[model samples]
Target: MILITGATGHIGAAVLDQLLKITDPGEVAGLVRDEAKAAHLKAQGVQLRVGDYRDPASLERAMQGVRKVLLVSGGADEDGLQQHYNVVDAAKKAGVACLAYTGRALQNPATLANELMVRHFQTEEYIRASGVPYILFRNILYMDTLPQFVGPQVFERGIQLPAGQGRVAFALRQEMGEAIANVLADSRCDNRIFTFTGAATYSFADVATALSELSARPVVYTPIEQPAFAARLHAQSLPEAVIQRISGFLTDIKNGQEATVSTDLADALGRTPASLQEGLPTIFKL
Candidate 1:
């Protein structure tokens, strides 16, 4: 049986959908914190196991009889590393045959988001040390995040953060999730780390142009200094810590650190991943 944690999340749900298409429903288990939140999945024939990363016993219970486990990272928190460690430890005790984890793409130890990367690296280390075969999917930035970053400005004033001409290889969350499912199903992917991205690279201006084409509105890209950008986000009611984190990420992009596209995703799925243009309509509902 395959146990998928974070089954209610964006990528997790997409992974579940893809798995259901190729595997028996009885062979798939969804480890969710809230059983009520997973009623739809339960009705769809997925075995529901109540679990949480903070609670190792819950993960242990959910992992029982599981052959494979997909450890989706917990969302924005300082304790993300600890939570992932708990899940990894539980999986170790469960003697799962294989494990899969989602990590960030191109996260260098010296970069601004290095702390997050370090946590993932640490988790990978633990999984490897536990003698369990594992696959680490280092995913690129999501095209869905573009909407979250650009939508408010478009609705209020039709502006976007012109982070210069730097390119970002962004992919649809569903595409990444599908790739994860493919990895989980493939027995040959043991002990591998795949960095996944879209089929093409795009600059921030390119994103603005696409948005303009989709919305039929003239969206303007406004480049600003990192500090100024952080101040703007702060003024928009974002918490100071969040503003800092986002600004740091934008800085990394502006410096062209996260631009490269890789073919690992295609290799894993045995098909080309989706491009930005192909994913635009789905993201913008155009």
Candidate 2:
């Protein structure tokens, strides 16, 4: 049986849905912390196994009779690295034959100034040292995030960010989840690293242009310095941690760490990945 951690989350939930369509529901097990939240999945015939990445004993219990596992990275917290360590150690001890993890698409996340990327690098190292057969999916920024980053605000007040002319190869979350499901099912995918991204790339300027055309509203992109952007966020009463993360992300984008375009996603899913223009309507509810 295959066990997928964080199965109630967006990516994990989509992965489960795709897996069910391609394979028997009996062959899949979802690691859920709250049974109440997973009642829908249980009703769909997926076996619900209670497990928490912070709890080693619960992970071991969930890993019983499991041959393969997908370790979806933990949420946006400070304990992500330690939580990944706990899951990797338990999976190794359970003698899991194949292990897969979702990580950032940056070639060297540790070298970047971003805290989140550094944690991903640390988790990757820990998984390598665990001696378990593994595959790493380096995922790009989600197109879904565009709604939160630059959306209706652009139509009203215009868009502003620390990113310069830098571009991002954004992929839809659902497509990435489908690719993950395909990789986990194919034994040949073991021990390989894949980068999942859209077929095209776009910059903030390009996004503004697209919105202006689609919405028939004049949207403009204003490039601002990193410190000034942080100050603006602070004025809005955003937490310091959030301001730091957003600023660090803009720095990475400007450094070209997020502009990587790859064909691996199409190869895995046997089709072309959706572009930003194709996914914008759904993301912005247009």
Q: Which candidate is the best by lDDT?
A: 2
**Which regions in candidate 1 have their CA more than 4 angstroms from the true location?**
none
lDDT of 2 by residue, 1-286 (tens): 8888999999999899999988889999999999999999999999999999889999988998998899999877778789999999989888888888999887556558677788777888888888898999999988888877774467898889888988899899999999999888876635889999888888999888888877788989998898888888899999998888888888888778888989999998999998777888787767
Report the lDDT tens digits of candidate 1 across residue range 1-286: 9999999989899999999988888999999989999999999999999988989998888899999999998877888888998988898899888888998786464654424556767777888887888888888888888876675557346544636676789988888888889778776646888999877888877877787877788776676676677667778898877776676567677767668689988886788877777788887777
Count of steric clashes across candidates, in order: 0, 0
Between which residue pairs do clashes occur in model 1? none
Model 1 whole-model lDDT (C-alpha atoms): 0.81
Itemize residue pairs with steric clashes in candidate 2: none
**In terms of TM-score, how similar is model 2 to the real structure?**
0.97
Which regions of candidate 2 are displaced past 4 Å? none
**Worst window of 10 by summed lDDT in candidate 2:** 107-116
For candidate 1, the per-residue lDDT at 33 reads 88
